[model samples]
Target: MLANADHVMPDELKFEGDKAFFFAALDRADLIVHGRNSYEDQPNSPKRRRIIVTRKVGAVARDTENPNATLWNPHGAAFEAARAQAGVHTGTVAIIGGPDVFDMFMDRYDTFFLSQAPRVRLPGGEPCFDGVPARSPEQVLAAHGLKAAESIILDPAFDVSVTAWRRDNASSAARR
Candidate 1:
């Protein structure tokens, strides 16, 4: 997400580097999980398999319109079951998000790729994560045990950068 300094949703924010990185990651992954709103906003790509998390549905069901997609209500089915239903046996599962979906996998993510466009700011837009008040994306991810590992300036002209964070087990253990 190319959010502003306030960490609000970047509505229709388009960054070429971001798009390239996202699609490349999707290409390598076997399953993509995202919130309903996110799924709806994204353009249809039948080549990749997807699981759209939605509260409106009561069960996991294959999308009739898209053979590569599945509608999953996490309240009704376990994550593993949903993946199985989507025919994903073993492979990388990318969590593309809305705040709620990101929050749901807080502890499960081995790594997080955070991209930001510091020049842009969406004051009233939605946040990247829910239930966290007045926190930066890095702060939120750090609270969940991830530590910044590498930072890359994807576009120097726009001050757009991508930071990769990995789970810090030692820090987490120390906290306990």
Candidate 2:
């Protein structure tokens, strides 16, 4: 799943790196799972493929112009269903998320790819990952069942770093 913490009204579609990562991950899956907030925040564009998982069945509509996307609730069973679907592929199944959704699925995800903002600050907006206290993003991921798998510094212009983690299944102490 591709995600970022930005102002709610911000056009995240314009974020080149985030959007590029999102699309790249999308190409690996025939299905995409997203939270309601992220789903509702979608911009009008063609060639978008998505599925919205919400509490209500058919609670929202897909943009009329976005022919490739579909909406569904999965009644909070999106994880199981997505797992079933993704099991067919040895590739990845991303859980692109807003905070609530991330909080819900973080422990269950096999891995997480986080794009960290070292010094960037926002005025008023929800966080990228909720309930995680202010600390190094790496430390936060370690608190979950994740261990740093890779790290990359893209353009210095963005002041952002990309970090990847795979679930730590080795030991009980590894549940960070």
Best-matching candidate per lDDT: 1
lDDT of 2 by residue, 97-130 (tens): 7666677766766678888655555545466676
In model 1, the Cα lDDT at residue 2 comes to 31
True-structure lDDT of candidate 2: 0.57
Write down the lDDT of every candidate, Cα atoms only. 0.78, 0.57
For residues 22-128, could you state the per-residue lDDT of candidate 1 as single tens digits? 77777789999988666423454677898989876797988888898888898999888889989998888899887888888888887888887877756666677
TM-score of each: 0.85, 0.66
**Candidate 2 wrong stretches, greater than 4 Å:** 1-15, 39-49, 58-78, 82-91, 133-136, 169-176
Runs in model 1 deviating more than 4 A are 1-12, 40-44, 131-133, 169-176
In candidate 1, what residue range of length 10 has the lowest lDDT sum? 1-10
Q: Quote the positional error of residue 158 for candidate 1 in Å.
A: 0.7
